[model samples]
Target: MAGYLTTHVLDTARGCPAAGLKIMLYKLSGNSHRKLLEVVTNDDGRTNAPILPAESFETGSYELVFCAGDYLRATGQAGDDPLFLDEIPIRFGMSDAEAHYHVPLLLSPFSYGTYRGS
Candidate 1:
């Protein structure tokens, strides 16, 4: 089977899926960052489809930028001025081209965490 990439976000503070959050995918090489695509989370806190599909799967460095501040503000969880957690960027390396990569974000207004999920 071929590989692909998928992601999701959960509002830990609200204990629910983070719907409507914007996410950006980027391909990185050296000091250059190339945008792959932009997508919004659905009601299930997941993209409608794999962000990185099997046909385009690659083994390299990639980044996912979650627009947490916007989501926080929309949910009335953001504070005044600057947010402690704004655009959360998670950089990771995919070494296996034939593996399914699931990255999930556990987020709150003040903090966040991520892990390689199934």
Candidate 2:
């Protein structure tokens, strides 16, 4: 079995998908981080392809940075300074290289949450 990674973003405030949101994937190593990929959410609040394809999947610690504040501001929901939730970073580990990892974010201007999904 081959492993892969995926993600999804939802705008809970507007009750719709978070389109055009920017996402960055980074591989972490000993207090150092290397960016792997950058992607934007589609109309369905998902990337057009997997965040980490099976060919590049590896067992390690990874971080996902989501530009939620910019997204909300772009959608006319947030203003400058003192923004509630800005960039959200999710750090997780891949223990099983053969299992699928789905990180889904349910977000609003003031709050957000994420979990491992199927």
Candidate 3:
């Protein structure tokens, strides 16, 4: 079964799992982003666990920053001038405290996509 805020990083450029990628989950505050959680992608390109636990659900705006540039660089799949996305920030709103919110990201060097999931 999948958990809330589950994400997978697929290096579309190489069609491989983006392991060791650091990701930070943040909630939008008044003027700055409040960090909710931080984790690195595992071998399967997934987090070790859901960023949001069962007892930690809350209503707020969230952002997920994917360190794609570093991930690609470490994997030796980056060019000197590779346009790695420094930060891929996805802004979303959570209104249901009891409902689960899953955010998945499919990323490439040149582009990326995000969507709400179960």
Candidate 4:
């Protein structure tokens, strides 16, 4: 089972796929962090391709930064004041290189949740 990384974002407030949300993937080692890739969600609220393609997938710590605040503002859902949820960074570890990693985010203007998916 070769490994890969994928993500999906759902706009809880609008009850639809979080289209146009920005996502950034980072590879973290010790105190050093390196940006891997950046992508935007499609009409299905998912990347056109995996965040980390199979060939580039590795067993290590990684981070996915979701720009929730900007999405909300662009969609005309956020208030003018400070946002409760901004760039939502989900840090996770890949212990097995041969496993599929699906990180899905359930998001709203004021709150968000994420979990490991199939």
Candidate 5:
């Protein structure tokens, strides 16, 4: 069996879908080639679809890079100090082939969070 990776971005500061944020996914190095997963997000702060397709899934670490700078810049949220962490990475293992992974992020101008979700 194979699994898929899903994610959603909620801007706690803005209280809306981080509509224009850019993001990237990388499969950690392992037996697999470990290449950059296709980067995509939607108007609702979620990916148009899952990051990993169900058929090509496997066990390994993955990193999600959220373009916080881009999001703030576009939204006029970036401050003069740039205290907000721009590149937020969530690294996790897809250890269970039968289970789906959902990585959800709630971010603000100064902070953010991420974890292995349903």
Candidate 6:
């Protein structure tokens, strides 16, 4: 078995999956970040496939940028011009080469939370 990365977003304000949210994956090295890929959440708030599949899995620092502003605006949760929470970036490191990593975001217009899930 090999390691891979997965993620999802939930709209806590609406109590539903954050469909149509855009997410970007980046691998960080020192002061630079190399974009890996960009994906959109489906109706289930999940990507159609793993963000980092085993074929290209790596053990290092990575970031997941969730386009929370767009989702908030689309869902009419954003109240003003400047949203309290916009693009949410979560940075983490993968240590095990043969492990599965699941990162999920729980978001609202004013706040957000994340965790490493199974």
Give each model a TM-score.
0.98, 0.97, 0.86, 0.97, 0.88, 0.98
Per-residue lDDT tens digits for candidate 4, residues 26-93, read 99999998999999999999999999999899999999999998999999998876887889999999
lDDT of each: 0.97, 0.95, 0.79, 0.94, 0.80, 0.96
In candidate 1, which residue pairs clash? Answer: none
What ranges in model 2 sit over 4 Å off? none
Q: In model 5, where is the ten-residue run with the lowest total lDDT?
A: 31-40
- Model 5 whole-model lDDT (C-alpha atoms): 0.80
Question: Candidate 5 — number of clashing residue pairs?
Answer: 0
* Top-lDDT structure, candidate number: 1
Q: How accurate locally is residue 21 in candidate 5, as Cα lDDT from 0 to 100?
A: 73
lDDT of 6 at 70: 94
What is candidate 5's lDDT per residue for 7-110, written digit by digit as tens? 88998997998876777888878655355665646889888878787976776888888888778877888888655578887777888888899999898989
Candidate 4: segments with Cα more than 4 A from true spot = none
Q: Which residue pairs of candidate 4 clash?
A: none
lDDT string, candidate 6, 25-115, tens digits: 9999999999999999999999999999999999999999999999999999999988898899999999999999999999999999999
Instruction: Please write out the lDDT profile of model 3 over residues 1-118, one tens digit for every residue.
Output: 3224567777777787888999999989778898988999999888988787766766778888888888877877666774557678888888776676777778776788877777
Residue 23 lDDT, candidate 2, scale 0-100: 99
lDDT of 1: 0.97
Candidate 1 lDDT, 1-118, residue by residue in tens? 8889999999999999999999999999999999999999999999999999999999999999999999999999999978899999999999997899999999999889999998
What value of lDDT does candidate 2 attain over all alpha carbons? 0.95
Give candidate 4's error at residue 55 in angstroms.
Answer: 0.7
Give the residue spans of candidate 5 off by over 4 A.
Answer: 30-33, 81-83
Assess candidate 6 and give its lDDT.
0.96
Clashing pairs in 2: none
Give the alpha carbon lDDT tens digit for every residue of 1-118 in model 2.
7999999999999999999999999999999999999999999999999999999999999999999989999999997678988999999999998999999999998889999999
